[model samples]
Target: MSRKATITQKEIVNAAFKITKKEGFEQITSRKLAAAAGCSTQPIFRIYENMDGLKKDVYDKAAAYYEDYYNDFNKTHEVPFVDLGLAYIGFAQKYPHLFRLLFISGQGTGGRSMYDLVNGSTENVVKEINKATASGAGNAQQLFMQMWIFIHGAGCMAVTGDYDLDEASSVAMLESAYKAFCLG
Candidate 1:
């Protein structure tokens, strides 16, 4: 029998993910993925029916990476909610292409809008905000949504490089806006 193949589907998908991270999802062509994977385009076709299938896998990978990256601060920080907000903005600034793919281009919503996805994921965040605001979690939905809108705006600006935000000022903004939304 012939020797076993050297590369696997996961490796190929990971290479595609790296390319998506650097160049955005739209740039994930067969050639680009092949170049990133350090192999010919044959492996891509051998593993996936087409670029779309590979792209779908890549999207799933990126979503998981995004969630993991954001959730990393869940236990480390004293103020996990504000820390998560800062992490969101930091992710945008650090990975603009991934940010565009995840937030602006809207490639991986699975038929749901990003707004819906974000709102749906805010259950835990609402609980955190409730703890911070001394309000009940059930009552913090609107407050969390408001904070999300602002935090996401800052991330968008970071991705676009239109505004250079400093941490101190962002912290101040987060504090004031959070207080207003949570108490008002």
Candidate 2:
């Protein structure tokens, strides 16, 4: 009688994500992942051509989850900018390690796609600013850049415990900064 294996591709990916989250991405290895998944490296190699492929799959999965979080907030709120800022903080607080990997640690190829997601969200804010200001002299691109910098800086600080504020206070400060950016 032939016995079927219990390990699967999804299980492998899930194990990889858990390992990376707990032990940082730099430490991830196919053998480590295989062991974590309770399988041999052959399964991983059969599912993914190489380490890069596995990493890409992991990054894409994380990105999808991250995007879903942001998209859920977007669907519930009318103001995309404020919601995006809150989402930023929420993501950082909820998944501190993943947040660091996505934005802080300079790892993987997903950074460009992550930037595009933020840029797309910021463009909506720029549109709002344009509508509010009614001034052709102001540059939306520049405004978006400034706002992104501020939001990212705040998010990094909050995630890294550089700031002393509690969750409520940190979110409030971020909202205030966003509103101030809109006004200026």
Candidate 3:
């Protein structure tokens, strides 16, 4: 009888993500990822056309996790845009390597857009902005793009060891920016 397959594509992708989170995205490889998943490279190749496919899957999973994280916060409490900015910083601080992989640096050969990393999160933030603002003159998408650029810039600076603003200071800065853009 044929031996039962003991590995799965999701397991491989999850292992790859864990590897990336622990040892930076630059160090992740098919062989290392396969080892972490406790499977041979053949199973990885069977599920994914190549490493690029695996990378894309990893990115997708990360994005989903990020979205869920933000959504969970929303469900628990009503946080402002500035609070979301603080959460962004917290995430980066907590997972410096993974944060770099998802935002600061681009990985894989799939030509995936950086915007994909924040797709769902950004959408939810925009919806909150819309609800917070009653005028509704400008489009939420445009406002979200502007706020996202600001947040990403600040977050990247923090992750790259460039900015040293503390949590309170960061929240203040984000609040100021949100007022200027989303509220004003």
Candidate 4:
């Protein structure tokens, strides 16, 4: 009779997530995951068809975690979009490895265009933009795209450790960009 598996898929994923949290997605190898999971690599191969499948699971976990982080920030702020932008940068500052894994390195995005990315992900934020500025959907989308470019840049900067922008400065910069986009 075949022996029962010792390590579960969830447990392996949790170990992979921990490795990703500390070392970024690129560092997730079978050997490293085995070390993290405190088991032989055989269980990982048994659970996942290949490393790509495991990476996808890890990416999904990171994405969900980021969404929760954004949602938590939105709950406390007056302007959700502005606060979301701040939260995006703050997330990068706080979790640079995850930020690089999710955004900078293009682990999950694949070949999707920026247009598709914003349309698919920011429907609620666009609605909030319309409510806040009374702009039409087209204008709101435009503003969001513009702001997203700036916010993405700030996030990248935060992860790179090149810029040391404090919260106050970040808010001022976000406000300036928001007003500029709103006015134009």
Candidate 5:
């Protein structure tokens, strides 16, 4: 009789996620995943059909992370909107490899644009933007689009290591963009 498999899907994904977090998705070899999971390579294949399957699982986890947890920029800054922008750049600087996977290489999201991810994932902050801009929710969304342009630019530059901006300057630029949108 064949032995029953014991490893779960969550375990496999978690192990892959950890490796991807540190080394980017390319490091997710069968041996590395097995070592991380404390199991043989057989179990990884048993749980996932192939590396691409495992990658898709990890990609979902990463997407959910930015959508839910990594977006908490409010703890550092009084203004949630500012926190949101700072958080993007900080995430890029902190996770340059992962940032490239998410934004630059377009590993996930099925060719959806970054603006879609920004707009879709950022509905939580519309209320804060509304309050800051003293505008209706409709106008606040427009403001978010403008602010996102600045934030996304900095984030792209951050991962490229081309423009190493300090916190003060980033905040000033975001504020300026916000003000520009609010004016008209």
Candidate 6:
């Protein structure tokens, strides 16, 4: 009779996710994952065809974690449009490992174009921008894209430790970008 396995695929994925969250995706070797999961490397190989497969699952988990974190920030903040950008930079500041994994490594976007990436996921953000700035759909979208460029740049800088940004400064920059984008 075959022996029952003590660990599930979900458990292994969870362990990988934790490792990736704390130490970045590059750290997730089979041996490391097995150690984190308290199992042998054989189970990891049995569950996943290779490390890419495991990393894909870990990427999905990291993406979901980011969505929840970003959405929760938007829900509570008074200025969802500008504040959302701050929250993004804030995520990079707080979770440099996860931020690098999700954004810097370019794994999250897959092959999607920037247009689809922003427009597809950020309809509500556009709506909020429209309401706040009284701009029409096209202008709101343009403004969102413009501000997102700044926000994403700031996030990258934060993740790379290139810039040490404080909330007050980030908020000021976001507000300025919002106004500038609203003009053009």
- Please report, in order, the local distance difference test score of every candidate based on alpha carbons: 0.73, 0.68, 0.70, 0.76, 0.74, 0.74
Output candidate 1 Cα RMSD: 3.2
Q: In candidate 3, residue 178 scores what lDDT?
A: 63
Residue-level error in angstroms, candidate 3, position 14 = 1.5
* Candidate 5 residue-wise lDDT, 64-148, digit = tens: 7766655555545544367678878888998876777777776665665665454456565554566665544347767777777
Clashing pairs in 6: none
Q: Which residues of candidate 2, in runs, are more than 4 Å off?
A: 1-6, 74-80, 108-111, 119-138, 182-184
- lDDT top scorer: 4
| TM-scores of the candidates in the order shown | 0.81, 0.72, 0.76, 0.85, 0.78, 0.85
lDDT of 1: 0.73
Candidate 6 scores a C-alpha RMSD against the true structure in Å of: 2.8
TM-score of 2: 0.72
Candidate numbers sorted by lDDT from highest down? 4, 5, 6, 1, 3, 2
The alpha-carbon lDDT assigned to residue 154 of candidate 3 equals 80
Residue 106 CA error for candidate 3 (Å)? 4.6
Model 1 ranges with Cα > 4 A deviation: 1-3, 74-80, 109-124, 132-138
Of models 3 and 6, which has the larger TM-score? 6
**Clash counts for all predictions:** 0, 0, 0, 0, 0, 0
Candidate 2 lDDT by residue in tens digits, 53-156: 77777776666667777767643333324556667877776677778777786654745645665544445455545643554425555555666787787678
lDDT tens digits, residue span 70-116, model 3: 66653322334565666677677667777777776666235546554
Q: TM-score of predicted model 5?
A: 0.78
**CA lDDT for candidate 2:** 0.68
| Model 2 error, position 155 (Å) | 1.9
- Candidate 1's residue-wise lDDT over 1-184, tens digit each? 9766777999998998888888887888888888888888887788899777877787777766767776663434444256757878888998888777777875764675555434335455655665665644345667777778888999999998975868777777777777677567
